[model samples]
Target: MTGSTTRLFAARLAGTSVFDPQGDQVGRVRDVVGMIRARGPVRVIGLVVEVPGRRRVFVPMTRVTSIDTGQVITTGLVNMRRFEQRGTETLLLAELLDRTVELADGSGPATIEDLGLDAVRSRDWQLTRLFVRRGTAPRGLAGRLRRRGDTLTIDVDAVVGGVLGLASPDADQGATNLLAAFEELKPTDLAEVIHELTPKRRREVAAALDDERLADVLEELPEDDQIEILSALEGGRAAHVLEEMQPDDAADLISELPAEQAERLMALMDPEEAEPVRRLLAYDDYTAGGLMTTDPVVLAPDATVAEALAHVRRSELNVPLATAVYVCRPPLETPTGRYLGTAHLQRLLREPPQTALGQLLDNDIDPLAPDETLQAVTRQLAAYNLVSLPVVDEDGHLLGAVTADDVLDHLLPEDWRDADEDDDLEGTSGKEAAGA
Candidate 1:
């Protein structure tokens, strides 16, 4: 227990491995449990650790012996029970990262980027410093040309002195810091972070993301989360986000809402953008039509290999959707003129740039019918060794394309997204190790 006072940033501690004195890993840190007071600094209570089964357990600060950049060392027997939040407990990452607070210098409100915890004694730790940012961080061109915001660490007591520490549940908070921290994460990873937050905070964070970004995250979330977050947005904004999502995804989400609510949102959406979603909604949820994406790469039969390559090169296109370019007669959009055939990317690359896509079409495989069952779609993809397949109507017009990912999503267990949320262990607080 005798060592220089240890200081660790909450962000650094997050996800760091926790180990026993014998060098055996116990679990990874999910979050820091702290006690926020009406005055003074927040006291570090324990660490929320996720074990092998995704069960969260508490390891008190009293048991911690070492804090390093990559790992935490603890003494005594570790508690294995589920870590439930007490009335006085706060999850630093889940509740405080994006909180907007007034600075003591009167320079304006700042967003908390990270927090620093210091060991006050062998068994006591306290939140002592706040890493925060202030100023508008405009995105796109402006973000690239200019600096984001002034970030610095200040005494935790500065803002916690009075009633200005963390904002209330309903208070308007900026997600700049939190979003910045998660900027490099994939949509699925970001969805996991958002899934752990409280509903109100989740709504605030969702509101801060742009329509396209929100659409990406929403697609990766569970059905209930998608419904909740979408319902919380203003009608127009919600419609815009839906428009950014894949037509099939947007249709599925809309179908889950109450009829009146769904109608209202669809009405707010641009008619041109809502058309494809509306079309998909007419089909059964488990059918090829419902699972197909209307925005897959499409090209006219006469399009050159170069043009087909260009369409597949779009940065926004997902891998499966970009794997092949559907070559149709005229009216290249979904429900396209004639379902000619698909020109795979590999084939396109092998052809001369000036060669027409129609010459490279792979029509040997039959396209899927809109009414085809999800199981049938899966079988087709597997049997054909294809990443995506075209969906055509009875009239031989292309409706959309069903990708491997879409089929896998439906075939997986319904609670697959909730795999990390399982909390079967029941208990209040976990017991400390056997000995001091």
Candidate 2:
């Protein structure tokens, strides 16, 4: 939903009602049947159409017209009479359902499951390959066959149709040679690959992936990596990705960039995303006020530990680094506002349900003031090894907390050094030197 490539996978239209060219109802899609590889143009295979009497028929993918949220539109009613049942030797639908396949060199494979695409050198789509179910090996002698022999020579279109009951037009180019080795990759694996790329390369890869996939990959990246990638994206796309990022992480990133750049990025982002960053930006960067996330999990001072746990479950996505739950008055404030002392999430989880946050609060907790420099902030953060250091004004009014990650960024150098150069004007007169 956040990145372009992810949107493709998340956009699957299965179970939608299929319609014919005349707009007559055909059947609902049971699943994505399969896809044809080695075909000139890649095509989707359709399968398992529910019919009258509770019967289901397998249909060729060629009959499909369009896929939408609730229904799949088809060109026409596939005359079931046209399809003859191949012998039992035919591959069963269950065998290929959600199965992963390696694309042969020079042939493209459409994903039966969602296919991830990566961009190489900023030109065209590079298929990252399919996500197949684990543990099941391909059946028959074909499983044992190596790169040689007729057994390895599968008719791509026929195999697709026979396996998933779909047909595809021939393709001009063959499947990508590099994709043949990767059967499937976990989201974390993909994130690591993205991490290895240069900033430009990362942008290319991110652009190729659908929104939801991009979001997953983004979530997996380290906070710093997320900042670099988002900074590289075009404004609109970057904004979309930021919208999907955890608010706390997103805020941290925006807080690091130059003020003008940060402001521009926030303006382009969706309001829900921009607001948190705006709140964060309002605080001084080196202080806890600037670094603390607004979305910390909090509970009323009087609430029982059981109620606190419930709040945590509901806010997990927003408050991942919830080292300690802050005990505050009713009505949670933005991190830039008031709060009380903190209680650890781990301790709360282990504590008795009847325990109140007020009883468990650590009275010795230290708070930070705004306008503190990076040098001082890092020292405190390092000394305490605190996951989150709360910030407050002179009046003891809470602002936000400085997160460990943000503090680390401030400690690191953001730019490369320039070679020092000396001018050779030692022998020149004062007037000459001034003129030069």
Candidate 3:
């Protein structure tokens, strides 16, 4: 069915337009699908085709007659049902992109940023080479990665000391064994890598992170990046990640979107998590209401110092929120709690463990009104030399607290958060390099 066929990197296959023999455009290659095996070769299974209107459909390999540079031709009818990854299926784009795999040698895991696919016996398609990037000096790479790290491509067998072939276990593989490597990397480190990727590539990796972990990485990325990744996700998935994020951070992200889209996403969030963000979105963009986070530490007026200290020790509290605890009256949720005052960490340390939190409330620092302008919030923060400032309503109810980071986000250059640094890994592959 083919005049000639040539091997190409799997990544190169992505985004190519697929056409019928009559020259009718069918779709584009979104991902390469393969069937993984326990003790045999992982065979090419099908192509995930992104069809207009339908989004994505599966075209089994048997349907295709030929695959060549930038094109794949089908010999039979293709399945119109959307592709759902099966137990035995591995989606190359989703599973292998930006993945770090254990090396054939015992040195450590090297990231498989790009992959090479060649025709087996010059006929069947198979992943043949791994252009791996190592953080440390190259080991079995024999200076290949270190010397031509930017452009060299080597067969998997060469790196694996001439193993049986791509079918063997001792090869640079896909996502099957990636949990261990990812577990060792901090969220910040992972975020740096994601930042360097295009929105599509970044999303593939982001989808792999757990909700809480994804929240942490989202917070580390710039606002533009945060929006891009979030926009790429389905509303429900975006809602789950937003629910895991700090209320203020989530609100800040929501505020950046068109009101309609933001509202749609917010509706997908849990009622409890959406409440504070909803309130924050009602305020002007430059007001304290917009910058404050509803997840700040809050304690009942009758609570003790020990209770306050323990609350601070809880897993979910970010550093700025942990710096002080707001002592409030009944109806402690946002838009209701009476603004009693704040209890500083220093005061908690000096007071007797059992002392009532209300007794240690500092009256000097005034809680900001939700309508207060950003300038006022800034002046108050500087006047008190504080990193966090609480926001209250007209009825004197505690709403949330704004941290210095939020204020700095506005005062800094519009592009301040856009700087590129590959990473600070002991042997970091410049922040932007690894992700690309």
Best by lDDT: 1
Give the TM-scores of the predictions, in the order they appear.
0.78, 0.48, 0.59
Total backbone collisions, model 3: 5
Model 2, which residues run further than 4 Å from truth? 1-189, 198-201, 208-235, 251-264, 313-320, 335-337, 382-385, 412-436
- Candidate 1 collision pairs: 77-433, 77-434
| Model 1 worst lDDT run, 10 consecutive residues | 427-436
| lDDT (10s digit) by residue, model 1, range 148-259 | 5789888875663433365354276556556664566668767876877778878878877888999999999899999999999989899999999988889989999999
State which candidate has the highest TM-score.
1
Give the poorly placed runs of model 3, Cα more than 4 Å off: 1-182, 420-436
Better of 2 and 3 by lDDT: 3
Clash count for each candidate, listed in order shown = 2, 34, 5
